[model samples]
Target: MTVNIDKLTITTPAATSSTNLVALELSGAQAIERFPQYVTVLSDGSVKLTAPTKGASSKSTHRTRCEWSEPTNWTLASAADHWNRQRMTVTKVNSAQKVVISQIHVRGDDSPPVKVFWNKGNITMGFRTKYNQTTPVNSTVLKGVPLGAEFTVSIHATSKGVVTVEAKCNGVSGSSGALQLDATWGTRLFEFHGGVYNQVDYTNSTPAADGSICVISDLSLSHS
Candidate 1:
């Protein structure tokens, strides 16, 4: 008898002009309509994202981010569990302020269950429980990640609202211990977000000169 094993492979589809692109604003009445020039999808399946000083809305000034959501409008309440992973590199940072690399958030909640950020030339991952909250209740998980370096980031959440974060940089790896979720989070829906989200606020007289550029080669998600 003879047996053979089959090989498996996965590929990213080429992006086109009509790709479903979405943007989120921390505060504003108008929704971002058009895809900005700063975002580009390369032929090699890598996405280049640049956060400019001026974002979509003028009512509030902060870094803008675009995320890929399946079905264009799925919410957190739509699923019981969530998982996401990505391989990315930071190419440029205009300032020392923290810039969000990715996040797992619920609809209408200002704060996300997990967020990965680059701050002062280091990587900081945090978990937040409360809804509409700005700060993470837990401490940073991984730090000291070098800029311009390639890294992997992941997030997982159970149906019970237990959350965890995994990260690897320069062959060093770590994970965030299980974080209990706030009761409010379970009442809403969630989504995965990636790109550059600057944490600094802009002023009228002096607009934010801070911006960041990131290249994401791989991004995956699953929910049940």
Candidate 2:
């Protein structure tokens, strides 16, 4: 069949513009608007995961993974029954130099008087300990501006384990508190230790950057 382009007749309203393109194909369209989805509450008045979309899944899911220069694997193990349980294993790392994981956000307890261990990191600014017993139990407390141009809190833990944090506002004294942090070798501290010591389990400790009154709730040792 021969196609006739000149005989084609289309209906349209008169326009002033000489070049006017009508609606194109359906594929030549873009997203117009987006709206929030409505969710129904359950009988117990609890909102549950009704949809498994990207945003919803993200807000409800927890991620965990490891990263390294070499092959490594991980597995989950019960802390209480460490001796009889299977721990997370780091399997392989062929050529992938790194592994990453977004761990689950743990906010189960917020009460003071909770025990935590120095999972890792330098407890005292300049003081480093080789053994758990050598660690200092912070005692002395103060309130003032840290020694810095911008906002920075100076926490000094002496050999006696005396810990003090001074808040500095514009390089002046602000507020301080006497905090008690316990350094113990527990399951939490296990990973932070045996390496460079850059990890610690800070329980019920409030060290805010916005200059909130930092306080030590229950600073003790965390054990497996």
Query: Evaluated with lDDT, which candidate comes out highest?
Result: 1
Which residue runs of candidate 1 sit more than 4 Å off their true CA positions? Answer: 1-36, 58-61, 66-80, 204-209
Q: How well does candidate 1 match the true structure in TM-score terms?
A: 0.73
* Candidate 2: Cα lDDT at 55: 14
lDDT for each of the candidates? 0.60, 0.19
Give stretches of model 2 more than 4 Å off. 1-149, 182-224
Deviation from native of the Cα of residue 58 in model 1, angstroms: 7.2
Report the C-alpha displacement of residue 121, candidate 1, in angstroms.
2.7
Inter-residue clash pairs, candidate 1 = 76-189, 76-190, 77-189
- Give Cα distance to truth, residue 23, candidate 2, Å: 47
1-224, model 2: which lDDT tens digit per residue?
11111111111111113453321111101100111121222353321111111111111222111110111111112232111100111122111111111011112211211112111111122122222333433321213222211222333333232334443334344322444334421112121100011121112242211110111111111113
lDDT of 2: 0.19
Worst 10 residues of 1 by lDDT: 2-11
Q: Evaluated with TM-score, which candidate comes out highest?
A: 1
Residue 172 of model 1 has an lDDT of 84
